[model samples]
Target: MTTEPAADPQAGKSWSVEVYRFDPERSVKGHLVSYRVPRLEKMTVLDALAYIQRYHDRSLAFRYACRLGMCGTCTVMVNDIPRWACRTSIERLGGETIRITPLRFLPVLKDVLVDYAPFFAKYRAAEAYFVPGEERAEIAPISPKSRERRAIDPNLECITCGACYASCTMLAHDAEYLGPAALNRAFTLIRDSRDGARAERLAAVGGEHGCWRCHSLFNCTEVCPKHLSPTRAITGLKRSIVLDRLRSRLR
Candidate 1:
């Protein structure tokens, strides 16, 4: 755990931050508000927001848990790029002016907090779960060197923080599109030997708005905090589906 230095009133430092402000009860609208905060070395954007909430304004609202970037709850658009606030250092911002906004492709709840219901709802719709077979009592061993297991190695690290979804242009145009994380999870199960839901899972994601919707932008791969590439998983799913279809035609 990294402990931030105590606020120094005598410190000759200041930063101008543009924060998106919204209160459901206060107004039917939202806008950006500027706040000047004392700067400290190694201070993060989350720390800046917390300082403003505690000192300058008590009404500011945002979502954050496990401030060390594990939970992925502090994700937001910093200068139009998706990043975890806890991991972004204020010194690396390159300027004294900071622009903050709610994540794109989601409903803004208040301030920088966006409603995640739709994101998680798509996860459920994609049936992103591991299904065990009836022969569970028999301990079936799968070699780590197997192609399927090796393929799913990177896809298994997803934290579902909605960063990729927020950065995705597919969701920006079509809300029904299953975002990368869900598709990645689906692909993982599709390749699992223990899963009995492959056919059903394929049916769920084989539509026009399913795995085919990915445009190969690689934006999900670019913004993932855990460095997991959902785009790769999605591509693997497409290959699996195409091979299966071709095999069926041959039969």
Candidate 2:
């Protein structure tokens, strides 16, 4: 007589979670470490990480702030796609497996934590700060229907998560590329009529490493956690560059 094996009740409730492990302090090179995690109702990627941190491994390193997904601090590579860990649910990813890693284009500081120096450096190179139009005594009124405002509004909700910059294919190839986040930031300022730095800002984002270099593959738009479109902004900047050069020739 053949005996039938009993089916485990926990069969479909567990997942294979592989996280990229690295720690220069411990002399461990980067590699993926697997963890078997049990499924919970509506559990998020960040929740899984938190569970691992609390129960399985105490030495694992990751970053998160404003667990509500407001700070964009929990950004990581989830199955080769950059995402906000706090907001990405396990159920949405098929509940079978998950792989987490540091931003592909940035230097890894530790296990999933990346150094954002280069990302912000390119941001500063674009002169992203507002060279405010003469100090306003009160709120300077900008019409909602104005063409410039319309062009600039959609691109301004960026959380500076470095997700767009990290996912950019240009950065994967060229280390010096200004990247989508920087160029997108420059576009916002350049389109503002009240801003005094149009010429300088244009120069900042228009050189060999600037908006003209965007491949327009839409990778930046795809991986952005905030849904901001850096491709659209870069295209607008390219148009402005052409128009600016023409105006200069006419003058």
Candidate 3:
């Protein structure tokens, strides 16, 4: 975590970084701490945080991994918008001051770090995983052009970073709501020809606290790091439920 301050050659351009700070163990109330940092070309919010920690304040805490944007772990609220810190370039932001905070709808563990336990709990409640079918001597082959394959292709890119979960307004009001990430995972598995527990998966996500609760605000779609759309996936689940009910009634 230590780096020579001189290593950053572009330490001339100054910008203010306003960070949300709190610790339940040490502090009664959380507040924002400001630091003026040097900006470089292509400097990301993650870079700014690293600079702040390395130079201004070692006590500043945040979560980040694989600074290349492939890992969703570096997610933070930038000016009230949920975005991957690594992916957001400071140059793109036309402001001299940037507000950095932990994701919303989750308890803040510290500065820019939020508790994800509740988020994963919703995931499990939705049964967001593939259940393999009976074993066979040979592996099954699925065509790339198949409807199910095409339907789930984009969703397979989900990194489970909780960006969609954090950006979700639905989760803010309804804690029990199976968030976009979980429901999106459910939709992917439901559409997968390789998964055998489609009925059970559907039941999990179609319950009272599931896909039906989504208000279709599309916040999940806007904040997705991988550019995948959970709103579309949740809609797919809703359509499946309607078709299933219609089939049962007709029979």
Candidate 4:
């Protein structure tokens, strides 16, 4: 895919890119490989990666889809910070050299690609999915201004991007800890009055390596593409757990 571009004065400018390379099926170790990329106006990190994979080295492997950042396929560490590659412009990066690497604290299946199984497993452990009650004749209308809806609103937009999970110091220390996204998901489900598994889900998130384990570092919130606040959700869980226990003792 070594395609010569049409005449343009900006063609002379290029970005220095260093991408991590690995193939578990073949090699036991990995290394960083560098390439020179053309400077296109408002170009993104994903654009650079595609250029490398196509015009430079077909063997280079990375994942991407829906280049609009809705899909987390192009998630990677740009200069050791977790971010969506498709949305990160080179201009925003503010440097001529771009360093790309895989997300940390997960098994790397290939270059810049981490297995999402562990991240998702924690969500399952937290019982993050909604457990609906018996089927009804009609859908129940939830008020937009209701307390439950308001509580669930700010923390409900998680994209499952794993940027928070990757940047989390808590997860790095204790792998058993239910991380930001999973805990955030649990909070949303717990706040829904219609969910059948409120007690069970609340107990799950309030237990060991659960919401209490979070240090409120806010790393997840910082890198969140959708601007969700998992730290705050965890804190809400902590408050709910305490109140629920106090009520039980009083009763």
TM-scores vs. true structure, each candidate: 0.90, 0.93, 0.91, 0.92
Any idea what lDDT model 1 has? 0.87
Per-residue lDDT of model 1, residues 76-148, tens digit only: 8998888899999988987878988999888999999999888888878888787786666678877888997
Candidate 4: clashing residue pairs, number? 0
Give each prediction's root-mean-square deviation over alpha carbons. 6.7, 2.4, 6.4, 5.5
Candidate 2 residue runs with Cα over 4 Å from true position: 1-10
User: How much lDDT does each candidate structure score?
Assistant: 0.87, 0.87, 0.87, 0.88
Could you give the candidate ranking by TM-score, starting with the highest?
Answer: 2, 4, 3, 1
TM-score of decoy 1: 0.90
Residue-by-residue lDDT tens digits, candidate 4, 1-251: 69887775543498889999999888998999988999889999999999999999998878888999787878899999999999999878887789999998888998988898999999999999978876678898789899879878889767788898999998778988889989999988878888888789889998888998898889989998888899889898898889889999999
**Of the candidates numbered 2 and 3, which has the greater TM-score value?**
2
> How far off is residue 94 in model 1, in Å?
1.3
Residue 93, model 1: Cα distance from true site in angstroms: 2.3
- As for candidate 4, its clashing pairs are none
The residue ranges of model 3 lying beyond 4 angstroms of the native Cα positions read 1-12
Model 1 bad stretches (over 4 Å): 1-12, 138-146
lDDT score for residue 103 of model 3: 91
Q: Candidate 1, residue 117: CA error in Å?
A: 0.9
